[model samples]
Target chain A: MSTPYVRRFDSFDRVLHGFLMLSFLGLAATGLPLIFSDQPWARRMTGILGSFEVAGWLHRVCATMLITVFAVHLSRLGRRLIFQRDFGLLWGPRSMVPQPRDLTDAVGHVKWFLGLGARPRFDRYTYWEKFDYWAVFWGMGIIGASGLLLWFPVFFANVVPGWFFNIALLVHGEEALLAVGFIFTMHFFNGHLRPEKFPMDRVIFTGRVSLEELEEERPSEYARLKASGGLAALQVPPPERWLVRLGTVIGTTAVSIGLLLVGFILYAVLT
Target chain B: MRIKHWLAFFSVLFVATLTFVAAKGPTNIPMKAPPAPSRPAVVKAPPEPANDDCLACHGDPDAKSDTGRRIGVDPAKFTESVHGALDLKCVDCHADLKKTTDFPHPSKLAKVNCAGCHQEKVAEYDRSIHAAARRQSAGSVAATCVDCHGTHDIRQKTDPKSLTYPLNLPATCGRCHGDPDVIKQGHIQIGNVSDLYKDSIHGKAVSKSGLMVAANCTSCHGSHDIRKKSDPDSRVFRRNIPNVCGSCHEGIKAQYDNGVHGIANGRGNDKAPVCADCHTAHQIQRADVASWRLDTIRECGTCHADKITTYRDTFHGQVTSLGFVRVAACSDCHGAHDIHGKADPRSTVAPGNIVSTCRKCHPTAGENFAKYDPHADKHDKARNPVLFYAAGFMKWLLLGVFGVFGLHAVLWLPRGFRERRGQAKHS
Candidate 1:
């Protein structure tokens, strides 16, 4: 029998994630060549994109999309807190926010990886997942702010000192490199390339997880939901085969592009 | 006494003979003298050969000299010539054959003297290097009048068929200048300048594009009195190059004259750059080309070594170094012809004007944005301490993150493999 599914993310969240994935990949693909413009591959890539000017336009368009996704995601959270009065999102087992339990889980998880202790039972969001969430927040502030300064340097010159441009240039490039490196390698590994999820984890795309997967991955949350009889409310019919296939295609394409971009970055940095 | 008496008588006879000859004039004097005594004696003038008389034998298609050299001149081409159109007689230049009554004259004749008619031009050529070389060497084949202008078929310089015409002048000069054998024989120091000019912007304009105003060999180097480049009066001489080029590029010359380099050059600073120093002489290319623009950075660096070194550290310099021209280059900020000291009010990079200069690329650039030092050197702590420390911090931060995370990812590979193996075993 097909295992029953549980809705982990709403459709809105899934669509926002899709936009985030696409825009981030677009930004990295276009921006990396500018940073490493001296490389032959950078020239070739820019040529493929028509010209450096086109690459620049593509980068700014992608940046706008990313900014839109960030704004929309924030507004949704704000609506939940203000209108729906859902304060549980701010602090709880299901919260994206870091709690004291995340510290214990991190230490325990590392210990388990080292074979010195049993694996930690993650409730809903693991420490790494929380880290990824907050990293985006930090990335948005630093990279986004600096990028705006560079994009509109003349306008910003009135407000800031001239030396600020040099500093902004340095900060924008370095922080972007850090963000791209983190997302492509660390985030990819944690989200999909781990032993259990060696190929991919499509729950983000399909917006649902099988009951067996939820039980195995987050046993504590599963147990809590069952005891409170909240599991019935979250339960759903199995995701359609077509939906799963669509998610797989999208998920695989994004992963492949991300990995390919990472390969280009490595080639540029190494040579 | 007898010898002395005879000597005196002979001297008196010689005087008498001289007096008689002076009074009688020549034996060929015309008997029909002027009726008035005030009119001078009219002596019979020598018979001259007409153009047709010379052309009778010389115009034959197979006419040859005693030594079997072709001595023929085509009548059709001669009729169209400047001298022929003027109806000049053959004896006008061949003055030695003027009085000759013989049907066939000597095979060898006196060389035609072009200076007889073109005295001023010949005087100028006399002072030229070619004339000097001819005077120094016995058998020197240095260019002469007939070498450039055709002997019988000479045409006006304005005519397109003229050798000295603007369009054909390069090839006329290139006959010797471009010939490897001639260059070797003449010990020419500057190699194949003709070939170099053929590929240059001016040469292509004149030859390929057929631009009448484009400079040729005779434009920079004067036609009649072309001198050695070392001669201060030579148009191509170092100090005179600006004026020579300025004759064509009036506006750029005006701007350059007001700039620092021009000012220095005017002050007799030989080291100060002139037009040829940067753009070169014969191999000059259009400055708008990407390769030329990139190359001009190094050309400028030839003088401003420190400035170029610092410029190379900037984002603009780095991008340009990679062969991209989207960013600003040295001349983009400094101004190509009107470059000045930063303190100068007219300078593009001056304190008051820098903001507007930055606005050329960044339309909304304010004073604060203009403060960005494009030539800031991170290694110089005293001058750029902020940049120095910031560059240092970023360097370590990148290395630290990559080092630690790289190590973590490396260690995780083994663990990941073992976990996967265990899962496979279970399955």
Candidate 2:
């Protein structure tokens, strides 16, 4: 029997995710040592990066890539909205926005988790996915802004108070930590680490989900596609096993690095 | 089969060795015992003079000279001197008198050479700058043995009556150094170094505190072989400063030997400072004192112009400039003696160790806080654009994040509670 699959994301989204992962990892790897420069391990890590000067260079390069990738993503979203006139992509169940149904789905899921009601059947997007998506806009804006301020303090200082520099340092470091912590803990678990998805769900990387996975995770979306006669048009050959394996390696490495960083950060915060 | 046989043989050998080792060890080794003292003591009188008849006329109380100067001598005072104690006669020093048979000498006597008896001291004096200056200028500005120690009344330095004793050294050296005629003639600024020494920390200790081990003139400069600092052989030479000071300041010298400046000096860099450069030869003060520690900043600033300027703009620099003594200075981070480059792991200012160094002033400072460079200038974007942008980004981010997140939290908390209540009703 021919295994069925559906395209969940296009190549552009996968490339964006790749860029983000690489840049985020680059930034964290080169940046944390600077934040905790007095650590012996931090010193060794900086030595590997070729001194604080080299680390600074790596950090600036990664920061530029991160900023560019985020800008490209927003521009793509704009182009979709303005040129493509995909008004539906911005709202409702198909959109990355919260809706009336999403609230019910959230309340229903809570009841299920609490054992008071049945689990809500998610469509194209769940309330958690919406939260995750919306959080990026806020986090990226905050982290990016603070990063810019730190990168051009003298110019900003001429226009603003000196205390702003101190504030920038605090926010940039704290927000970066928050982002790393969340992506490592909440996002990893919800999207990849949970038992149902353990080891991973490779749709984000391969841009395709197995039919069985689609049916199990988003039965409502499957039923809606069937009802609208779009299911047949979306169906394609299942992703190659090697592609899935490649994603496993990428996902596992990314998550492991995240876990390591989170563990160190927790130690710093608690201690 | 051969390996097994060898192992068995080795085991037997090891067992035999263990048995021998367990036996009691011998305590004694063949060594000769030292012999006891055998010399006998005997009562003896002072050596008899070669010519007691010379002292009879010369040591008289009413003796007169051709220049009308009294030549009176005190018998007891003479007996107490080093020469008198040795029972030397006047003719021994004045050898020309032995040639004279008449009461009045036929011709004048040649100048007596102290080297006739004090050969080592005379040799040392010959190598001295004073001796060189005397030969160059052909003048009496050079100090001979009689200049520091009187010819007829010379005493051992151990004696409290000696002019060379620690307590009397300042006065002895200052005699010629304080004289305006000697200063003008020799073209030397003598009073500044020796005369002012009497009012310094060492002088005060020697004069008032009765500190027996206090440094004196001869402590830094050799008495017999005193030379200008420009001479490498001089005790006060710049290259020999650490050793000269180290004789007394052993601990500071040990610290300096491991320091960057000391390491540089060891590599033959003449630019590096030695003891006398920072702390003057004569007027050194207690380094621990607040006023004196403040002076060290200016001294360090002399060589590190750019660093001092940046440091002055820092919080520590501002506080120090305002006369606050407790603030951290260059020596506080880069240690006073054990200073090294930031790349050196042992360096106090190295990235890995900077936190502890900072904690000296900021007790609770963490690695994060230490990341804030005290000498960094936010006004120079060309050097540090990241810090500049970070500051601006944080300012606007704080305002936007607070405005948005603050509103979100304010609305969400009450909404969350309402949603829970609604869920309860539905359930």
Model number with the top TM-score: 1
lDDT of 2 at B227: 93
Per-residue lDDT tens digits for candidate 2, residues B293-363, read 77788889899887877676554664455444566888888988889898999999998898798778767
DockQ of the candidate models in sequence: 0.39, 0.02
lDDT of 1 by residue, B77-155 (tens): 8878887664455676787887777878898889998877787889999988889879988777788998888788898
Point out where model 1 deviates above 4 Å. Answer: A47-53, A84-88, A98-123, A193-196, A211-232, A236-241, B1-72, B82-152, B171-212, B223-240, B264-272, B277-298, B301-329, B359-366, B376-390
Over all chains combined, what TM-score does candidate 1 have? 0.75
> What is the TM-score of model 1 when looking only at chain B?
0.79
Number of clashes in model 2?
Answer: 18
- For model 1 the local lDDT of residue A31 reads 81
Model 1, residue B109: C-alpha shift (Å): 11
Cα lDDT, model 2, residue B21: 66
Instruction: List model 2 lDDT by residue over A1-271, tens digit each.
Output: 8668899988898999998888888888877765554355565677676656676688899889989999999999899999999997877568888889987987786666555776688999888777767767777898889788777654565566544545565566757765665677667766876545666778888999878767877989988898989999998788888988888899889989988877776665566
